[model samples]
Target: MRDRGPLFGETVLFTGTPKSPEVFNLVKQYGGTPISLPLIQVAEIEEADDERKMNECSHFDWLIFTSQSAVEAFRAKMLRFGFSADLIHSKIAAVGTKTAAALEKIGFNVSFIPTVFSADTFVKQFQPETNRQLNVLFLRGNLAGSLIKEELPFHVVEWTVYKTEKQLSSIGKILNILDEATSVNILFASPSAVHIFAEAIAASRGWEGFTICAIGHVTEQALIEAGAPRVDVKPETYTLIDLVNALARRKEGL
Candidate 1:
């Protein structure tokens, strides 16, 4: 929180989902003016994806959750299907502490939780030695790429439990930031949010002056691939608090 005091009175534009409010608070603690307008909306996958969720979820030896939205989407869909104990298997693995906390909130005893918050780290540390082909269930969103399957060697059964829809804020808000802030720092948590912004305004419209602060390695890569400007700073710890700290550090080099 005390990294050279460079973030005093800076504006930080948060681009994460609605589940993120602590990020705004963290920005304030780091002495940055936080502006949060969700650029992506999370919703349960309708129709065919629901059927796929029910079909693939029942037989997995390990159920892996990558995000809190995935956790909520899977739980809500199970409740709708009248699933008592059939929703998840006895074994569960969460990608990070936040995701594990989301599962704990719903009373699911998480058998495995990763120390690091990255999918690459989770795949490195948590893959158990299996002599036979292990069936793994990946509960994720429409925008979540096939990273899990590429990282895990087990037989994967993926379910698109949720969908992230892109949204461009009213031009008034964008203009207000342009008028009010000295420098705009757009914060990105997920690659989906980056892609959403690219689809709407990032690549196709005017965003030449905003500084991008990505949460982690994957997100930084996503921001680059989406044709967004080069990231001004990226947190090594890959958390919102650390990202805010990194934003403060960005001022040191200016």
Candidate 2:
């Protein structure tokens, strides 16, 4: 007989792409069944003029990346335009550990990460070395808000490098999971995914009969506003590794 893991028999569904394959494997290591139901799709916005505008990236004093999606889009554009990391001399600020890791993976050193992994906090905590008027470029998706650009005292420029759209195809798969599994854990990584789930599934069926786990406060608030009965789990730190560890601890009653 095999030893039972902490998450024995628990069905874990990911509403967003797992940061890495390790996240999915972690659930299985704990004896849980991992399922993927990405509720949002992100793709780079390929504008013909962007090839010219991308040159502006080298002029900014600071380059900000708020999400892994933004990093991915920026990377794709850089590769498309034949731009190298050495060409962009701007200091990089990443909002979360994952974003920073993604930036670092591409040979760019990250200069800043806020005390918390939230944009609201990033706006409050990020300060450059000098008080001079600095040019900051924020690379983001279409669904992103203007909080950083509006709140930052620096001269900010926004480049919409990516767009996020609802992944409707996952709706049927999620419903199928609900039908087959007696109890399942649904992990929400972004508020966008939460909103999609609310509109497509929760609106018709209601937010019940599943364990809800949110990655950050923003995502949790989205679930609250969507009228979920409750959010069953959330990590203290807004990272996928922490979120999964938190779920395991919850299952272990720690």
Candidate 3:
């Protein structure tokens, strides 16, 4: 099974924020020496600033959740203020199955989940009505994609519930590991992670023996734009598990 795992004995680094430990364990389960150097930190936005907008959630016809982070962050902050969870009575649209599952865990019914996981695909499937205007309340992070807002002619009211910040605590040590690792496979969960990791290792030739794995086209584009010459792993499903499995398949080929 370890041989089938394909990433056996490989040193793979994870840059998934707020969920790094779980991902680290997954890498090990697949027989890789998992490294966790968090490149991003997920934090809830100021409650005082977002409170009014969050309380006004009942005005929308559609409640959109783009990521699990947004769902978690919103619940944590809003529940602390004794905010009613019943504000989400509108039809719900989740970008991916994970997000839909997260919403379901919170006891919200998911009305739609796109076949494809990207924002572009989700946007394409949604048909906007000019006559019967719809108000969509988008709960998202600071670095969220604007394709939903750009493509749909809905009255979109977005609340930035969370943010991603750089978590580069020990850059020198991380760089050393990057240089010394025999066959490094860096996994990026978001565009910010790819951008930060790429910038931090730009001057070092440490990436010569490394493989860059991006979760989606957005993150893959970030890696390419940051000059990552070899983005060897990109999954079509665009989930963390899918990304890891794709890496396993790539290693099997090698």
Best by TM-score: 2
Measured with C-alpha atoms, the lDDT of residue 22 in candidate 2 is 86
TM-score for each model: 0.83, 0.96, 0.90
Q: List CA RMSD, all candidates.
A: 3.2, 1.7, 2.3
Best by lDDT: 2
- Candidate 2 weakest ten by summed lDDT: 1-10
TM-score for candidate 2, please give it. 0.96
What is the per-residue lDDT of model 3 for residues 1-254, given as tens digits with 9 covering 90 to 100?
44547778798877776453566677778888887777888888876666677666777888888888888997786677677556556788898888888878777888888887878888888764447989998888999878878787788887888998888784665688776877788888888887777677665554567788998887888888888786899998988888888998888877
Can you write out model 2's per-residue Cα lDDT over 210-250, one digit (the tens) per residue?
A: 88999999899999998898888999899877888898888
lDDT of 1 by residue, 1-254 (tens): 35535666677887787566787777676677888766777887767557555755657788889999999997787677766443556578898777888888876778887677888888888767667988888888887777788888888877777888876663347557767789788888998777777766665565577778888989989888888658888987777778887787777556
Worst 10 residues of 3 by lDDT: 15-24
Off by over 4 Å in 3: 1-4, 18-22, 47-49, 128-131
In model 3, residue pairs whose N, Cα or C atoms come closer than 3 Å (at least 3 residues apart or on different chains), thus clashing, are none
